[model samples]
Target: MQLKPALGAIVAVSMLAIVFWQQTHLDPKAPDAEFTTLSGEQIVLRELGGQPVLITFWATDCRACIEEIPDLIALHQQFAHKGLQIIAVAMPYDIPSRVKQLSEMRKLPYTVALDIEGVHARAFGDVSLTPSSFLIDRERNVVSRVTGRFNLADWRARIAAM
Candidate 1:
C-alpha cells in the first residue's frame, strides 16, 4: 500500500513538472520567425510587414482544418485587397506534395507555407492542435489567437475593428 502511494506521488510530480516546463517555454506573441514556402523558398515574418496578417497553423489530415479551408478562402478573397494577408502554415507532418494536392482540391487562394521544421509553430508556441489561428497586425503584433473552429463573422468583426 505504501509503495503504491509513493508511485502515485511520483507520477503526479512528473506531470506537474511537464506542465510547468511547457507553460514557461511557450510564447504567445513573438512574430519574427523564419518560414519556408512549399516551393522551397524561404521567407521571414517581417515579409508581411505593414499588413494585417492571418496566420493559420494546420495539417492536411485534420478534419476541422479541412472544413475551415472554404471559410478561410472566402475570407482571403473578401479581404485580400484590404491589406489582409492570409497565410496558411501547414505543419511538417504534411509534406509538400500532400499540401499541394490538398490546396488544389480545395482551391485555396492565399499564401501557403510549409513549416517543415515546425519552427514557426514553436516560435508562436506549440500548435499541435489543428485549426489554430493567430491574427497579427501591421506591426507584427499578435492581436488574437483562436483554437479549434472559428466563425467567419467573428473574424470579420475583428478585422473591421482593426
Candidate 2:
C-alpha cells in the first residue's frame, strides 16, 4: 500500500538525520599525551586547549603520507596565523633522523615530533594507519579523526569555521 512505502521512506530519512546529527554534534576529548619534537622540545597535548590543533600521524616511508605533506603545509600556512596549531608525529618505526631530515628538507613550517617508543601512537587511539589526522577544537574536544586521505576542501572549511 502507499502507506507502507511512505513509512519506509520516513524511516530512512529519520536514520539519515540521526547520522548527520551525530557527525556534527558528537565531540570527544582528545587523549592527553606528551609529544617530543625532533629538536627535543616537549609539547603537552592538553596544554594546547586555547587554540585549534591538528595532529597528524605519519611515517616516513608511507607514500600517501609523503604525498599529503604539501596539503598539510598549505593548511598550516592558511590557518597558522588564526590560532591553529599543527603537529606532525612520526610513527614508531620511522627513524628519528629520517623524520628530522625530511622535515628540514621540506622546510616544514610546523612542529614535527617523533614517536620513537609508540607512546604517541598508543595515546591517539592506537593509530596504526599512516596519514591519520585529528582535528581538535579550541575546547580540546576532538571534532574529527580521519584514517586516510581526507578531502582538503572539507578540512579547510572545518578549520576556517573553528
Candidate 3:
C-alpha cells in the first residue's frame, strides 16, 4: 500500500518533467509547412521570411485551445499590422467541420489552417498538444516554443523583442 503512494508521486513528477521538456523543444529553423487557409488560400511557412510568425497548434475539442482563442485573436489584431503573422493550425484528429465552425464562430482575425494530413504537426516538431505555439523570428529561427495556454505578458515581451 505504501508503494502505491510512492509510485504515484513518481508518475506526477515524471509528467511535470515531460511537460517542461516539450515546452523547451525549439527547432533550429522554422520548418516550411504549407497550410491551406479556410478561405482556400495556400500559405508557405518558409517563404514568410522577414516577418515574425507564430504557428500555433490547436484543436477544436480542447478546452485550453478554446480558452486561448480570444488571446490569440487579440494578439493578432494588435501585432498583425506590425508584420506579425499568426497561423492557427488545427490538430489532425479534430473534426474538420467543427474546426471550421469554431473558426467562423470566433471570428478569428488571423489565418486558420487544418493539419488534417498531420504534415503541419510533423513540420512543427510533431506537436501533440493543444495550444502549442512556435514563435519564429524574422530571420526564420524558432526563438521559442510554448506548450499550453499563452501568457499575455510573455507574448508582449516576445513581440517587443521582434
Please provide TM-scores, in order, for all candidate models, with all chains considered together: 0.79, 0.82, 0.89
Which stretches of candidate 1 lie above 4 Å from their native place? 1-28
Candidate 1 residue lDDT tens string, 47-149? 7788888989999999999889888988888889988988899987887899989888777888789888788777777776677888887777787777777
lDDT of 3 at 64: 92
lDDT of 2: 0.87
The C-alpha local distance difference test score for the whole of candidate 3 amounts to 0.86
- Model 3 over residues 1-162: C-alpha lDDT tens digits? 899999999998986787676656656788877899878899988788899998899998889989998888888888999999999999999888998899889888899998889998877776787788888899998888878887877987898789
Better of 1 and 2 by lDDT: 2
Clashes of each: 0, 0, 0
Name the candidate, 1 or 3, with the larger lDDT value.
Answer: 3
Q: List, residue by residue over 1-162, the lDDT tens digit for candidate 2.
A: 789999999988986665455445444888887899988999998888789999999998999999999999999999999989999999999988899999999999999999889987777776777788899999998888887786789999999998
State which candidate has the highest lDDT.
2
Q: What is the C-alpha lDDT of each candidate?
A: 0.80, 0.87, 0.86
Predict model 1's lDDT versus the native.
0.80
